[model samples]
Target chain A: MERWIISFCIIAIEVWGAVYFFDIFMERKRKGWLDKGRYMILYLATVLVALLDMYQDTMVIKVLVAVLELMAFCAVFYKAELKQCIFFSMLNYSLLFLTDIFSLLIENILNSKDELYALENPFWLVPMKMVRVFLLIVLRWIWKGKNSYGALSYKEWRKFGMVPVFTFVSMLVMYFCYSGEKKVQAAYLFLSAGLIAMNFLVMVLMQDILEKGELLRESALTDQKKESQLSHYRDMQALYERQGRKMHDYKNQIRTIQVLLKEGDTQAAAGLAERLTESIFVEMSAVNTNHAVVNAVLNQKFHVARGQGISMIFRVGDMSGMRLDGEETVILLSNLLDNAIHECVKVAGLGRKAVINIKLVEEGGKLIFSVKNPVAKKVQVADSIVLDSGGGMHGVGLMNVKAVVDKYGGDFAISCDQEKFQAVVML
Target chain B: MKIAICDDREDDRGALKALLEAYGQDFEIREYGSGESLCKDMDYIRECGIVFLDINMDGMDGLEVARQIKSECPKVHIVLVTAYVNYALDGYKVKASRFLLKDDLEQTLQECMDDILREILQEERVMEFGFVEGNVRLKVDDIIYIETNKHKNVFYTQEQTFNIYKKMDELEEDLKEMGFVRIHQSFLINMKYIERISSYVMVLTTGKEISVPKSRYSEVKRQYTLFKGVE
Candidate 1:
């Protein structure tokens, strides 16, 4: 009855911890924090731990709680922040190791191994065996989680750093506690079962995540291709229609001026002509071109550049209607134009000039598309289009052009002299 | 001789018409706006000695209008008028009689009208890059062919003259705007330079030739565009 009451007290404390965990987690959530729910579950699992202690001489529940606790620690940090997480994990492990050594020293100094064992000592072998089982589950749990999740979170991996330390200390304590006449056999079967399950779970999750990532990348490529194709046809029709409308407006301006002149109002005719000409100059080439993707891309980039007061000259001289298909033309021109416009607009406040020049010419059987822009800022290029000073997204347009050029067996190169950034594509 | 000017911008069209009227003594001028308007019930191209066209008109680019006018009546001269300098090349490829830049429209219009009169008198001379003996000179006209070997660039003229190279770039640089291309690494040949350009070699009009590099031959042909492309 005394044992049952003590067990009830332990279970009650564990249940309270389990319930309070939700409040801790939910409060954090309201402040925008993440919890993997492992902690609350492990605390509740401690109730099972107490009940298991009452029934079996085995340390299964203690080991299982350690396993779950280690997992809670791992989920605390994101995957791939490996070096930092591992460094802190080792620091915690060292502290546990020192405590373990100190505990062994005290046990040896007391010199009371046998009597302590039979007296239901805290360092006794049943608990020692339970601690050992717990650590095994902990190690396996951390390893399984780390490999699958791209390393355990800071907390969990740190718990792992404590593993060898906890083992050393627990082993010393076990030596002290199991020095009596009877020594309980360890639960070897559960250790094997636990690690096996963890390994299997890790394999399945890793495979699932990788496969999903691959599928997502391919889907994005196909979606971009379809959008580009549609943009091509749409661009041609829009350019044709806009220029058509502009011509009609031009004709009316002349007729209106002519009518005013015929009425002998010479001043009105001249005034009307001046207004029409001013409007024409300002709205010139706002009309879309023959390739939709290129048109949309250039129009957006042009607006972005114009707003910044960077002078831009984007003109297609002659494709000869045979140099490139609509799709290739759009991809090449859009990427080139976007990069030139972007760099041109980024420079600020200098007698320093900001200008973007793009020219396409057919020479020696190659279609040469050149983009040159001036920047006050220096650009540093790394492997894979990384700019030292900006987000990786700055190079995506160039990469898009590179991908197409490589597909077509063309040459693309970037060179800079003075403030000029030049990218040349030859196909 | 009669001439026509068509454009969507009234000022551009009117200014060009006035400039031509001031200089064109023997030419009668007709004006139209929009390609569709010109295409409907107008034989202005057939009656005119030349037509001044604008590429940015509302319904048709000056290029398309040139193409249609030439298709209908190839003998009519075409002078493309545009405020933008970029469209000048399209005028030539479309077989325009001349490209008139509006920034210098007054001077260019008179020169263009004079060229039309010269073409009528059968005394017109196109631009050319030439080499005479040791010196590379660009003849304004009368160049028959140009050839280059490993050591020297050569130019042949209408008088059967041969000029050798001082610098390959002299021809390319002096006549770069006049349409001389670097067709081969060893040879910067003019369009008037080649009698026949094949997969293997470029035969010059002077009976001298340069072998086209295997890598750059196709590119040379594509840029020169003496023949229609597969596409």
Candidate 2:
């Protein structure tokens, strides 16, 4: 096993170098390189090697490495645009299978190590290696154009991958038959074919399923974040609005006091109105929240509720001491409210109107927030991203909710019965 | 000062109300929801020395209302308010006091209102006419030919051509004297900027060639001619 480490290290370096060299070329070729993570996988190849080696020789290490490889496998499978995955992850894999064939051939031809060395001589691989590199360059062209870098279904992977798997298996079986190594030839062939097929098939299916699970976990998190942001924005909006209303209120009070003084009741009403204005000022200043844009968005959302004739109540929490920035607060609140408002506005046909209730409270080391609106229609779960598992304005605002939830240590969930569309999040 | 307003759209009527509240304040404001609203009630608008009416409306248009107002309420001044300026020539028939564009509300409206009020409301002065030296000593209204050369405003009347150094926009502003508008960036002729406008070319009155920018073609024509309907 230790003797294999040197070759593994050399292969690891070669694979990583080629991957990064291509990555640099891609980055130089495209402007939207940050959002385009096609080249990012090449870097991840290095990460895979190091991550796999983090725990070595133990079953736990083996499992962890396999899991890491599985993640990379999922990335390669789903990211269909970078068609170079075969030349990259499965790089020496095909060659190793071919070597299995060659080793059998040499064992029959000559018993010495020199014959094996001749087979591995790099000069002998002109056609195969050239085909691989040419394929890589073509795939790079596809990746550079960034056309559907990752949107492959399990079916698509199987369709494209069958030829390589069959060729490799044929060569391996021929080698095994020649090497006199058939124990359960039928079972071996079945299991080998099945394992390879399942490796590709199950990986795609599980990647889709796991990505969805991670997505759900993520969405649950962002839902909570969105709630917190909604409350934060709402609280800030309420503060600003109250301050604005106070200006009108305080001015009228002063006018009343002046009238009272003019009417010779200066001793009576002036004191009372003056005290009232002071109390109003105290209330306004106490709500010294830190956000203007979020306040505006929440205020607009509230106005939307008003225009829709829905009874939307906001329970604004004290977000003054909290650390969510203004822009994030705005984005989260806007998206959450937009989704909730859409649902709220849809609440009809039940011979009843809609009601949207927002509550924000901090409890037990978590920011607990809830937005419950009566939905007229039954809630249906959205379509899962079977191929491109990460994002888009897909299925629901679940991706957005998940992204934001993951930002903060939070949780998001929605339970919709016939009458109520309820979403609760904790951050 | 008195001014009458006419429009046919409920939303446009509301928008005009808001615009007037924001811009027009001085003269006692008379808002007629339609031309007939004021046409049926001309006696009510008789004191409104200036009439502002729209070209396209559900009922009677500004032209009919203006013709009627000129005959029925003789002393009441007529100012045409329209999205299209081509109504200006029809305005000449009823002796319209001024042409105000509704689209250019802030600058054009403010200036037009000021001019209308100055000449008719306070009754301080009337329209300013220009004198161009030529064989006939033509008034600016008669001589529709003015050409620009290097930095000078060259005059081409029915009889003579004289050059003067004046930029187009400035000259157009000053030529409130002769009701001149900056129709083209380079040419500032009086309401007489076009010789003949067609599917392609706008032949200038001066025999000079100019491209009528698509955005300004309808506006310039409406401001200068009667515009019965589009060709």
Candidate 3:
């Protein structure tokens, strides 16, 4: 009974750690009602699965139980779509399967009497649990979350799926070989270990490749943003200069009128005044965001939004203490505001009144940026995977913004209903 | 002195020619209404000590024309004449000897002509650096900025960009006397190329924007204004 309890505890801890690692990696969102009692159910469910695996001793039944547990966890807690859930399920099971197989191989390789006795001892479970925990921690550290796995396209998903499928097949084959009646000799055992290490090495290398591809794409987007922002700044400067020139010309015209009045040429002075009023046009007031780069982005985006006939309301309060550098500031604001304006324009095209509300506030040492725009078109935002089929990767800008925010270790959230799409970033 | 006046507008060309003629300087003047004709007249450009290039010419605007002229004859002075006052900042990018506003031609024209003559008579400073192909020389006035990439420094002049394997500190020290300012870890810009300093951004004449840190903005601005004052 004591051994049974020890086995249950070991299996429970392993399940819990795996779930934690999956949550960190995939950033799954939990249903509101299931949030409080999900962990208790997870522990109970893991305990029951462990009992079934131990007593039944059927590989098929054990696999079925593990699949059911993962499905239940994903259905109850995770808000991913069917495809994403399946992908993550395959990932989670493959990892757990590899770890279990690795432990068994280690046991088979060290087949001395003392080693066998140590494996049976309940105290030995602690080191086993520790090894699993350490491995999961390192895996999480290596898996950076800037380029979200959940947001990959179908082609990318297929490429990523190959690694897990390979791991599963290799680890399952090794497990069957070791578990067979044929005595596992040292030569075969060492070869199996070598194969498993190679499997892991392939996984790591694939992840590195994915990471580098994402980084290259991100930097390319950033370069594009920089180019646009430079043009935007120049446009804003040109507009301001035009306004200044008008003012300067007005002053000169006023001086000419004064000289004409002094010589009592009232007719010429009146005509000049008429011409001045005729050339006068409205120019929008400048936006001052305390930061020049942010100001330029806002001013330029506002001009664009206005040109699209979308009403824009901005309430900026004290952004001096924000930590973003000039390039990041330009990229973040322009991308966010540009996305918001695009969405607003879509609503306007549908004959609906479009409005964009932007607010920046500093609270508790965090700079909170929120942009809300109405959307007439449909948008599906599951966790962070925002998708719009009509827009064709329109969410790229927001993802880029999220990447910048993540670089600062900041918080970002996206929520949208049928009427409105809202994004909040805190840094 | 030999002078060339290039403007797409015949009236602008005539007006500038009349202004130069009224200046009472011993200058032989030629006029071209389009940049193509002016560029085609390489012999004229070689003989001409100064060119009054209109910024808004139809084909080959002033900036591109100035780039071509400066690359061909580094010693020749190019003065940008424009109705737009904002082109003053853009003038520095191509190392324009001076800028003359069409609106205030009576006052600005004489002043611009005097500055152009002074700059033409002054000795030019050129900096040489080695690249993959060979050693290249750049007139310090023609260079807008030098930026550091991952493994090399890119020297940006009006006409061309040269990649050189050199440290930023060494280049900074070398260009210090030539009025280059280190505004960021990765950026060293020629003070002469600065068109405007608005907020914390230094807008270069080449239309490139460089960010200035808040803590150092005032000092950079002060140094830039002092440099302008000295000029």
| Residue A90 accuracy (lDDT) in model 2 | 41
Q: Pick by TM-score: which candidate is best?
A: 3
Candidate 3 per-residue C-alpha lDDT over B87-157 given as tens digits, one digit per residue, 9 for 90 to 100: 44457568776655564465456645654565554336677889755898768778789899999998888
Worst 10 residues of 1 chain A by lDDT: A23-32
Rank list by lDDT: 3, 1, 2
Please list the residue runs of candidate 2 whose C-alpha ends up more than 4 Å from where it truly belongs after superposition: A1-99, A109-155, A158-294, A349-353, A374-398, A414-421, B1-231
The models' CA-based lDDT, in order, is 0.53, 0.52, 0.69
Please list the Cα RMSD from the true structure of every candidate, rounded to 1 decimal place: 21.3, 23.8, 22.0
Residue-level lDDT tens digits of model 2 in A36-98: 564455446545665666556453344334334533543443332343345223423443334
Going through the candidates in order, their DockQ values are: 0.03, 0.00, 0.01
1 or 2, greater by DockQ: 1
Model 3: TM-score for chain B: 0.54
Put the candidates in TM-score order, highest first: 3, 1, 2
What DockQ results for candidate 1?
0.03
